[model samples]
Target chain A: MKGNEVLAEAAMRAGCRFFFGYPITPQTELAAYMAKKLPTIGGTFLQAESEIAAINMVYGAAAAGARVMTSSSSPGVSLKGEGVSYMAGADCPGVIVNVQRGGPGLGGIQPSQSDYFQATRALGHGDFYMPVFAPSTVQEMADLIYDAFDLADEYRTPTMILADGMIGQMMEPVLLPPERDLSTLPAKPWATSGSRMERKHNVINSLYLSPNKLEDTNYERFERYEQIKEKHQRQELMSCDDAQIVVVAFGAASRIARTAVRDARKKGIKAGLLRPITLWPFPTKAIDELCDGGASSFLSVELNMGQMVQDVRLAVNGRASVDFYGRTGGVLPTPEEVLQAIEKVAAGEPVVQSAEPGAVGSLLPHPKHRKSSYERGE
Target chain B: MADYNHELLCVLSGFGGQGLLFAGKIMANCGLIDGRQVSWMPSYGPEMRGGTANCSVSLSDDAIGTPFITKPTALIAMNQPSVEKFAASVQPGGAIVIDTTLAMNGAEGVELADGVEVAAFKATEIAEAEGLKGLANIICLGKLWSLTNFCEREVADAAITKCVPPKRRHLLEPNLRAFQLGIDA
Candidate 1:
């Protein structure tokens, strides 16, 4: 199954009956799948006129206590930010998928992790955070999206699947999750369903007029965030015991880093991989544990311009030297390239810390203006 | 039965409408049939608009990390641009299959690393001769299978059957025939 289609199927099996989305490349297949499958299963699939409209529709459906979702690529996700913030302020539970592409403003349509900061730090103008799940493989795409809906409803907050185009367009065999019985789902008591003249009508709104009341709501939301940070921080550690250099990565970049770490081990380098499956609750505990265990250095590999490296640095907190290696604008760093970076770090050489203008140009040179290493007989 | 213990990374490249992605999909399905770990990833987005199209397929007994293949153990190049773009990247001791009918030079001027094997076949001409006009991709697949023996013949046939949609069932027989022709050629 393709990753995008697998996410749609998993969302369906997780009892999601409402899908509101606008078409965007790399993620359009997911919406098309929902448009084709949702109606046959007695669900609602609406193709709104714009991304803003789509996200607002998701907020509305979620307010009515439906397992609803919306998906888009990078720029479209920026347009939906306002609605996401609205949903967060209103305490609406929903799922948002960002199959990220190259960006900063109408960037090219290629697989990129440039939206890392956007997804984890500033999804919208807010003093709030969304639980971001990053899936590297097709199986994880299914497994994580299925859990995203439940996590959203459990905490009454919008959850995001922060995937890249590589996962979205890739194909792999997946064991589809079993369908959930809608009757067994948790009831949303705060939903604004009719009062039925039996009790006070429920109200769903984010507009708290008084300053004290607004501050209270923010404090309450942060309390739930703190709980999520403590319990829901998920990570995968590979060969971390007695490791000198630890590579921190997630999503597609993590897959490459995994291979590089294995290769480094074969070459007698004590390298390990720490992959964070959840981006919001950034898995700081795992890093602290590795640091406590005497891991000396950390290398953060990504498909962007060093966004997640900031988080890794924060987690390390001067306990170890943290380095950043990446290629932005939808370019993927090969396992060999990452291994070379690992080798440099092992040899006590400083790898480049940022995606500088010259560095980015040299990574993938234009075929017309410059000869590749192969062409240059290197 | 070929050994399925090691990894087989393949890159199939051609024009947008040349069915290279479909060929990669069938190869991935064959890996699944054998219960091996597999992944297929296509080069998507604007570059696919009248530009070169390619896909990477990885099959191995162990877990696959990263579906993108920068250095492939096997390559099937169906056009001149694809041959020029990817010929130099095939790993040492790797095998490459090219459609000489389209890529006339057939990696002649390219500087391939040591121990690389090259097999040139007039797949497009052969397919057209056999009334399989759009099946050069499958023919190239057959030649690749013959050289590498990545999987059993029965597994390849089963994979093709699984991939050919029900509405396009009539193309199955012709596809198999074209594949056999390439194997014999």
Candidate 2:
């Protein structure tokens, strides 16, 4: 199955009974796939009036403790931010899959990591936090969709499977979770399913008028956020130890960052890559661990100008000054450009990275091919 | 045969009738058949008309991130603009297969750089001359296999055969013939 199809399947496995989303570039297939498949599998799939209505529908469904989900590209996601805030304020447990497209506003439907700040910092109004998972490949996109559901329920907060246009668009070999394990999840205790005599009419709302009441609610949510950060600050460090340089990125950017490491190391630079699976709760601990002079300097790369670069800098905290490299306006930075940046970081030169290259290798692979040079240590 | 769960990234582009998207789906299905992580996203929105249309396909051992490629590791460019738009974006040391017949002005859009490996072939003309006007994608895929050695050749054949509409399955042999001809051409 396609990654989007797997997402639908994973949502089903997680007990999601409803999905509402408006079609947008790069993510329309996900909705189209769900629309056809959900009904047959006894689920609700709605092509809402707009992203607004879709997210609100998700909000309503999630309030009833139903496993619900909604997905959109960048612009559509921005429109749904208000609903995301409402979900967060109500402490609703649901998954919002942002198959991100490049954008400030109406950016072209190309894969980009521009939405990193938006996803990690919480895109909506007032102070709230939404955990965002940035998958580098299709398999993670599917599995994380399932995990997103569990995390949302565990914290009673909204979670986003923050994918870029690439993950949503690419095809990869991903295994389906065995059916048996998928059927073993626990029932939700908070769903408003026709409240029984033991429980009263439950209301899930963001509005708490009294300052004390609001503060109490916010504090409780904050406590949950703290617990989430402490427990689920997940990240994957690739070839980081005993390296002379480090490249940090998330989402599709992380993939290129790994490629850059291989290419750089081929040039005799001891470079490593650090891919943060979770964009929020920012993997500062793993990032700081590289400060043991494993790399004399660190290079922060992202599809955007330098949002996460700030986080990397903070993690390094002047222990070894960090460098920034990026591409904007929906353009992606290639590993070659990334390698150039790494060389600059290695040599203490100013940044001069560009998204231009001359040639490429053959596209088809041999039967006994290795997945990557790094894995093969070539 | 290639541990089907392995990730594959392919981008095919050309004029509308080139079957770029359909071919990408076939490749995607190869992974799906093996229960591998997969996604196929085709480029549209203004680029679908007479302009450039490309489909991004990725098959991997693990779940994939954005299916779109800002810098693809491998590509099959069948038009001038398609080549121009994506050449510079190719990952350094990545493979790019260009249909020389269609991409007449080679590297017009690409800046001079090291690392990216480029191979130009007469895929379109060869297919047409061989009476397979619709097999340009196959020819490109054949060249892709020759260059990267990324996927088993049999899987590509199997994927294409599986994706060809049933009513059109009668043409399956011609398609495979075209793929083989392109591979050895």
Candidate 3:
């Protein structure tokens, strides 16, 4: 099955009854699949007038205690930013899927990881962070969607599945998850469903007018976020025990990096791959431990203009050098290009340097760093 | 049987409406039925209609990496432009199969180096003669199967049966026959 189709089926099996989404390229198939299947299952699949309307609908369904979801591409996601922040503030549990395309404004409809900063750092308008899952394969895409909903309900927060156009459109055999019994679903006590003169009316809102109460809510949410980081920092470490160079990547880019790692290994280079399955948790501890285990350097390979490299740098903390290679606007970096970058780092050459402030490829020089035999080519 | 030790990456390319993606899907499904790992990624874009359409299929015993097949082990070109575009990208000793109905006459039309193995077949001609007009892509698949034996013939048949939608079940017999014709040819 295609990744998008698998995601929709997995969402159904995960008990997603309310799907409010607007059609967007690369992710339209997911919504279309839901439109066809959700009806037969007695679920609601709505195509809203706009992205903002779709996200707000998600908020409503989530507050009503239904497993709800919305999907969009990059530009569409930006339109839902305000509503997403509202969902976060209200502590609503739902899933948002961003099948990212190249973007700043109506960018080309091609796969990109440029939304890394938007998804992990500041998804909406707040100091809050959402747990973002980046799946490397279609199977992982289905598995993560199946897992995201439960995590959302457990934490009472929105979870985002950060997939790119490549992963969304790619086809691979996936094992569909077994359906959950809707009758056995856990009760949402905070839902705004009719109280019917019950014990007390549950008010689901983020609008705490008092400053102290809002501060308290913020503190409690941060506490839960910290716990999520500690317990759910998922990563895949490949050949890093004795590797001198570790390449960091996620999603489709990670799959390419893995191939490069294999190619490097065939050429007698001790290379490895570190794939961050959960981007918000950032998998910092995993990279730190690998560095402590004698990995000499780190290289971040991404499909954007190098966004994830900053997190890798913060994790490494100048203990070893970190470099980056990226291609923006949906241009996929070939494995040979990645292999070449790996070779440069293995040869102890400074392949990239911080050309400007806050740039992604910012390479801080170390006193112990060796000189490069080759200069940066253009 | 196909070699299970190494991976086989193949690209099937042609113009839109030529069933390139469908042929690739069937090959990937065959790999799955045989219990080999497989991935199929098509060239998705605005140009997908009336433009050069292609899909990469990888079959491997172990986990495969990078769904994009830059250096394919085999190339199935269903049109002249497809052969011209992808022939140079085949790895040394890799096979290049072109539909002689649209591509260069014989193997001399394409400009691949000598180390590459080239196979040319009148896929469209065979399909037309067999009264299976739109089954040219299936015919090409049969040639690919006969050459690489990536999966057992039974697996291909089963995949064909499985890939077609239930509404299109009536075309199964003719499709299989077209596939077999290319294999025998």
Candidate 4:
């Protein structure tokens, strides 16, 4: 199964009865698959007018306590940000998948990790956080879709999946998860299906008035985010315990990192990989564990110049020096290239001589120290 | 009997309808059914238009990296342009099954520098002959079985059977026979 199909299957298993999406490359097949499969299992699938409508439809169904989802590419995701902020303010729970393709515009429909900043940082708005899960494989797609729902509902926040077109279109054997028994799940308290006399009408609203009132609401959401960062940070570590080099990545980028690590190992350089499954609750703990005693050197690898690198530096917090490697404009670096970079760092050479920042695709610099636990990339 | 620890396949040129994508999917699923790690990826971007489409399907005993086949060990060509574009990229001594009915006319028609050429004419012919030309992709896949030693009969046969509709079960024998003809033709 491909990641998009796995995502659809995972949603069905999670009791998602509603999926609304518009057609876009890389992600179009996802919506098409859902259109076919959702109806077979007595679920509702809709092809909305635009990404705006699709995202808002997700918000509407999520308000009804249904496990709902919508998906789009990078540009479409940028359009859906308004709905995302509205969903966040409403405290609705659902999954939004961005099977990201290239660029700041319709750059290309090929796979890319450039959407990291858009997904992790607030894309649409005022102080808020939407948990982001990044899956690199078909099995991870199913696994993280389930995880996205659980965390979204538990925290009463929207959860986003930041995966690239490669992950979305690529096929792999996915270990289909056993269905979750929705019967065992407790009923949500704020669903608005017009309860009639059973209960009073529940309104799902994101509108807040007065500066202090909005601030309180924001604080409460942050409180939940803090809990999430503390408890919901997800990561994967490969051969890092006794490693001299640590390469950090997530989603499709992580899969490439794995190949580099293997090459590094073959060349006698102890290169390790740390992959974050959840980009929002950026797995700082794992990085800290790797860097604690100056035992591991760090390198942040992403498709974009350095979106995720900022998070890596934050995770290490000057406990260890950090370096960067990247490729952009829909071009992904091969594992051979990444391994070469790792070898250079291992040889005490600045593998990356300089990462030029442009007006459009500027290389993100190492940020200054900020007194915070983590920015939590989603 | 076809079996290997590593199998890499490239399927090219989309917009020829979904036939190529379907073929790659069957192979990938078959590899998985045979208990192997498999990766299948199709070409996107301008390659889907008035151009050739390419997809890579890989099967290995070990984990796979980069689903996109930068270089391939096995290939299946269903159209003339597909044959022309992908034939040159096949690994030396690797197997390439071409749909001769549409692609192979003469030695000048194929551009491959190396690899054994197995003319695959029966796929569309047999399917069209049997009034099921839509199964041409699978027929070619069956024919390629003789050329591909990575996946075994038991697994590929079962995968093909399961992937088809129950209503189409009556067409199974013809597909199986067409595949055999391609392998030996």
Candidate 5:
């Protein structure tokens, strides 16, 4: 199954009957799949006029207690930010999928992890936190999206599937989970589904007119966030027990880093991989354990300009040296390139760091395997 | 000779309109039918808009790490540009199947690595001659399979049967015929 289609099918199996999204590359297949499958399954699939409108529709559907979702790429995600924040403030449970592409603004239509900070630190202007699940493989795409809906409802907050274009576009064999019985799903008692003239009206709103009331709401949300941080931190540790150099990466970067770690081990370099499946929790305890387990250094690999390195640095907290390696503007760093970076770190040499615009030429090494512009006839 | 049981990293490349991605999908499906780990990834976005298109298909007995294959163990090049671009990237002792009907000078200018096997056939011409139009991709797939034996012939046939969509069932016989033609060649 293609990753995007897998997500859509998984969402339906999770009882997500409402989908509101605008078309955006890398992720358009997700919405297209929903548009095709939703109606046949007695569900609602609406392509709103714009991303903002789509996310607002998701908010409305979520408020009505429907298992709802919306998906988009980077710029479109930016447009949906306000609604996401609104959903968080109103305690609306919904799933938002960002099939990330290169971007500061319309950067490119290639796989990228530059949105790490955007998803974890600042999805929107808010004093709120949302659980972000990053899936590296197509099977994870199915499993994580299925879990995202349940997590959103459990926390009464928006949950995101922060995937890159590679996972969105790639195809792998998957065993999709069987469909959920809609009647067996937990009831949302707080839903504003008609009072039936039997009780007081249920209202869903983000605007608390009183300052203290709004502050109290924010405090309550933070308590849930703290609970999530404590109990929901997810990570995968490979060969960390005896590793000297631990490479920290997630999503597609983790897949590449895993191969590099294998190569490093073959060369007797004592390397390991730590993949954080949950970006928000940041898996600090995992890093602390590795640091205490005698790991010498940590390398953060990403498809961006060193966004997640800050989180890794904070987690390490000066316990070990943390280095950065990445490629931005939609370029992917191959396993061989990552292996080179690992070898440099192992040898105590300074690998290339993230470059600012116009200074990239000086900081970046020419990848040996990449085709030259003239060779590509560009 | 390449070990068919080992990890097989295959690249199928051609113009966007060609069936290169479909061929890669077929290969991945073969691996799936055989209960092997497989991943198929395409060079997406602008490349699908009348530009050079390619897909990487990886099959292995163990868990596949990355879907992107920078250095492939096998290659099927359907055009001159694809041959020029990817012919040298095939791993040593690996194999390549080139469609000479579209490759300029029939892969003569391309410099392959040491110990690499080359099977150059005019697949498009053969397909047209056999009245199976637009099946050079499958023909090359057949030749590549013949050289590497990446999967059993029965497995490949079953994969083709599974991959052909319900609407395109009419073309299955022609596609099967094209595969047999390449095997015979």
Candidate 6:
């Protein structure tokens, strides 16, 4: 199955029965799959008029103690951000999927990892963080959706599956997990499913008018976030021991970085890869340990205009030289480009630690694979 | 036997409705049937059926690093524009199969990178002769199959069986016949 279809089926298997989403490129396949399959299994699938309405529907269903989900691509996700913040404020548990596309405003429909800042730092208007899983493969895409639901419920926060269009459109063999029993799920006593004279009626609201109560609630939420960071941060390290340089990437970009690391190794460049499976916790300790293990340089690669470079710079903290390479606006970086960047930085060339995105130093050279200007009739 | 450690990357390109994506999918499924890791990614926009389309398929014995292919080991160009655009990107010693009926160049006057092999054939004409007018994609796949032999012919047959939906089961026979004609050619 395609990755998006596998993800939809996996959501169903994980007992998510309420899906609300609008059609968007790259992620529309997931919504279409849900539309077709959910109804047959007695699940509710509704396509709202807009992305904002879709996410709000997710919020409503999640507050009523149902496993709910919504998905969209780049611009649509931006539309859903306000609803995301409201859900966070209400402390609702839901799953939101961002099959990201190239963007600042309706950027081309090709794959991109440009939403790193939005997803990990500020998905909504508030000061809150959710667990964000960046899946590199189709199987990981399916597996992460199941885990995201569990994490959301445990933390009472919205979790996001951050994938690019590449992973969503790609087809690969995936083993879907067995269907989960909704009956086996943990009880949600805080749900607004009516009191029925059992005890006190549960009030699910984000509006704590009193300033002191709001501050206390914010503190409690931060404590939970701290706990999640301490326990749930996930990363995959490849050949970091006895490495001279380490390459860090997540999601689609990591796949190319992985191949480049292997190529660098073949050329006797002692290169390793650190793939961040979870972007939320930032994997700061892992970077620290790599620095401690005598890694002299770090490279951060992404399919965006250097959005994640800031986080890596923060984590490395001048312990070692850090360089960045990115391909923005839907163009993907090749393994050769990654290798060239690592070689350039490793060969005693001063790393251009530029924070300015799309600068000549921060991007791999323009693709020679494209038709020349003359051939393009320019 | 092909070395399992050596990965194969191929791209199929043409008009959006030319079944290029399906051809790529079949190759990917063939890899899966042979117990190899595979990834197939299509490059099509919101308007899927009228514009230019292409897809990349990678097959490997180990985990595939990425689905994007900048320099493919092989390519099948179904139209002139596809050949003009992608011919320069084939890796050294790579193979490219071109459909001669639509790709007017026929491997002549086309400047390619070093050591690339170009196979030009009238695939659409061949398909039409067999009353398989829309099966040129499969014919091209067969010719490419003959050159690269990425997997056994039987494996390709099984892939076609798996790729064709149950509702379109009747298509399997004609596609197989078209594939056989290309192989024979």
Query: Per-residue lDDT tens digits of candidate 1, residues B2-70?
Result: 233477899999888888999999999989999999999998866578788999999998888889888
Put the candidates in DockQ order, highest first.
Answer: 5, 3, 1, 6, 4, 2
Q: Candidate 4: where is the Cα deviation over 4 Å?
A: A193-203, A293-295, A352-378, B1-3, B9-15, B46-50, B104-143
Kindly list the per-residue Cα lDDT of model 4 for residues A171-211, writing each as its tens digit. Answer: 88888888888885557988887787888888889887788
Fraction of native Cα contacts reproduced by each candidate:
0.82, 0.48, 0.79, 0.79, 0.82, 0.79
Q: List clash counts for every candidate, in order.
A: 0, 55, 0, 10, 0, 0
Clashing pairs in 5: none
lDDT of 1 by residue, A207-303 (tens): 9999999999999999999999999999999999989999999999999999999999999999999999999999999999999999999999999
Q: Order the candidates by TM-score, highest first — what do you get? A: 5, 1, 6, 3, 4, 2
Among residues 3 or more apart in sequence or in different chains, the pairs in candidate 3 whose N, CA or C atoms overlap within 3 Å are: none
Q: Whose TM-score is higher: candidate 1's or candidate 5's?
A: 5
Off by over 4 Å in 1: A353-378, B1-5
Worst 10 residues of 5 chain B by lDDT: B104-113
DockQ per candidate = 0.76, 0.30, 0.77, 0.66, 0.80, 0.74
Q: Between 2 and 5, whose DockQ is larger?
A: 5
lDDT of 3 by residue, B1-185 (tens): 22423678999998899898999999899988988888998888864868889999999987877788888888899887788778888877677778988875545655665578777878888888878999999988898777778777888999999988899999999989988987897
Better of 2 and 3 by lDDT: 3
Badly placed stretches (over 4 Å) of model 2 are: A180-183, A292-296, A353-378, B1-11, B24-45, B55-136, B139-156, B165-174, B177-185
Error of 3 at B10 (Å): 0.9
Instruction: Find the candidate with the highest DockQ and give its number.
Output: 5
Over the stretch A1-378, how does candidate 2's per-residue lDDT look in tens digits?
455666777777677779999989877778888888889877899999999999999999988878899988899999999999999999998899888777788988877778888888859998799888988877787778878988998889999998877667655666665442435655666677777788877777899999999999999999998888788888888777788788888887887788778878889888888888887777878877788745678788887768887788877888877777777767776666788778877887776544343223222222234268787778
Residue B44 of model 6 has an lDDT of: 56
Comparing to the true complex, what docking class would candidate 6 get? medium
- Number of the top TM-score candidate: 5
How many pairs of residues collide in model 6?
0
Model 2, position A238, has a per-residue lDDT of 74
Query: What TM-score against the true fold does each predicted structure earn?
Result: 0.94, 0.80, 0.93, 0.88, 0.95, 0.93
Model 5, B51-159: lDDT tens digits are: 7899999999977777988889999999888988898899888999989888856668778888899999899998898888899899999999989999999999999
